[model samples]
Target: MIDKTTQPALQRLRLNLRQLEVFLATARGGSTRAAADRVARSQSAASTALAELEAALGCELFDRIGRRLQLNENGRALLPRAQAIVDQAFEAQDLFLGEHAATLRVGASFTIGEYLLPGLVSRWTQLHPRSLIQLRIGNTSEVLDAVAAMDVDIGFVEGSQTHPDLVMQSWGHDEIVVIAAPGHALAQQCATPQQLSQATWVVREHGSGTRQVTDEWLLGHLEQVRIGFELGSNEAIKRVVAASDGLGCLSRHAVEQSIADGHLIELATHLPKARRKLAIVLHREKKLGRGASDFLAHCRAAAAF
Candidate 1:
């Protein structure tokens, strides 16, 4: 060997995957304990890793706000780059293990999660049998937040809501139908707008995409709407409307089975058809890995069919 000791020393790497992992988890979870749980480390270890990372970068990444760790300017600036590096590392690992060994994280709104994605996920799982998918279900706004925060790889939601940090792609469309219990007075007749406005309604909570569309569609046609109840779950709304005289406006996929089973009736109304755009959302800065890319392609193909 040539004189190894006399050669210039290679600069050591100051940052590491562990430190970045802790940083990312802390940024998302807002606490070292949460970060530790996410990364399967002790809280003390996570805190040390975060501290070491800040020291290496010569800047504090997060602001200490009581018990929470909020991303300061430095953290925000590093997030996308860190995410890309970590994701590429995972992708590299999967390359050696095979495509089916990859994992995907998905966030979906209530309607899509409960009604739409099950069949699609089932089909996808059949094709990629060794793949793992973690699906988080939330309302549209929550899904948007998850995608923006880098907590999920991709999100599917209903509504036209836009986020500055996200790219939204039109995935498909869904029809919103007004339904009533079979015994409700409006169930058997073509209800006039005035009659429909006078009826009590059971609807989704305010943050829900279905609720947003319902307000726009109903308020556009009727002078005013009478509120009866606001529930979170689609199944709960369906049951409440089926058991009471309250009307409900929900996605067709959410209520079609109930209507077929005679638990609910589609109201014959004079109002125009209501449709909402379904969209796929992702962080604008995110570089999707093979698993996410493949799933997105699958969604596009499914939508086309």
Candidate 2:
């Protein structure tokens, strides 16, 4: 093993934020040329910075395969640390700037992020112009992880998961509706499980809150439903369902515009109401900062719950 403590001070001096930034860019971009472009530096400068970082650490962080670079174990290990450092540096800077400059990091699952959050964010910004909101959009699982890890100050999710590490509060309820193209066989009639199962269906991917709810409530009755497509985005699913003979179970909010425009028709189902609660999630032990508290209040008032 190498003696890290005896390393020369010159080596320590060379491992600066610039080198870390270059390392991160290279890791993410997967090419020195792309990293150089990302960092607004010449290719040579980026390469030099990466080299300095690796040499100072006395290890190879990446495997140079022809034109592409892949992160090795060391690089992967360093990535989160480097990101934490950069984020903390920004936070420290904000501390000096003032509380109003502090940012509220928000994570939202697809439906809320794409449809609902934009209006809420706009309203919040109008009320507190000085506050900054950093938004991340992903599936329900990703939003929960962000909240658990404290990467986001708050999260909005539609999934039915309750985590011990999170404090979950009901934000509102949303209805899931069955929809199809106007010409679909079941478009004008109430859909029976047997009739629905025979039709091709376009649905969201597995990790989505909408998909989870659909699986429990719809597919639970129609076990052998014909799945035509598993789409990643709600918009894509809507478009596919609107253009094809496929049926889709989606949030009413997601399909409202399509139904209004005659692209899609909401089908009546034989089952009970498909309603689910939308929730606001946060780390259990996390103290509410001013920005987070204000945003939470806004969400509660907007939801009227």
Candidate 3:
């Protein structure tokens, strides 16, 4: 296997934005025709661009099985770098259009994106009327990946673990509370381990920060609890818990409105209160632009937890 790091740097100079863009579009939409539509180019042009890009990079980026293209091992390895390059180019352009009229690209995990960031973004916008705020929402891992790749100026995440390539700044503390519908059997009483173990659980889908924390905190204690359903979003989980007899563990911020409206009830568990740090993440080597720095400062000063 050829070590990519050992490759000549000259190959990098041969890369063009159009080629990378075509490569990305083809990789994502899985065909040159689709890629052509995305990049507004002829199908033959997209195909030629991808082929030239692969040749310049010294490896085939995709496996051509009949007319369908799939990312091979080499393609998979190059995809992140290609995405980072393309996204960073756009971000750089946006950032340099005007320093004070800066455009900030922010990525956020589910909890912060849905509940916390709107207010912060609003406040930031008020402070800097000329500033542009673009927000991307994903699970903790996805947000972290975006930061590490320099796709976002910064990220807000609720997961306990931090990546080696990223730096995490303590933003605030969040409580992870177990909850249920008001009519649930355990809703009105403190639930013991055995009693909790028997109740069905509805949880955020696997990649979610909430799911990770629950695995570490809840499952660690009630090792054998039944998981009745695994849901994709915190809102979905909340809705399921509120309408059904199942129980769920989620961030306090996520369920505050539901709990207040009597759609859900925060349960008293035998275990101690579960809390985790919410953090702002960025690549360790990232040099923050003025806009990013300003927003980071605002986050540090504002008490949102």
Who wins the lDDT comparison? 1
Tens-place lDDT digits, model 1, residues 1-305: 75776454434568999999999999999999999999999999999999999999999999999999999989988998899899998888888887758679999999999988888899999999888999999999999999999999999999999999999999999999999999998777899999998999999998899999999999999989999999998999999998899999999999989999999999999999999999999998999988899988987898741
List the global CA lDDT of all models.
0.92, 0.84, 0.86
Candidate 3 stretches greater than 4 Å from native: 1-103, 149-151, 285-287
TM-score of 2: 0.70
* Clashes in predicted model 2: 0
Name the candidate that leads on TM-score: 1
lDDT of 2 by residue, 196-249 (tens): 778888889988999999888776788587888999999999889888888888
The 10-residue segment with the lowest total lDDT in model 2:
83-92
Better of 1 and 3 by TM-score: 1
lDDT of 3 by residue, 36-86 (tens): 999999999999999899888899988999888998989877766776676
TM-score of each: 0.95, 0.70, 0.74
Looking at model 2, residue 181 earns an lDDT score of 85
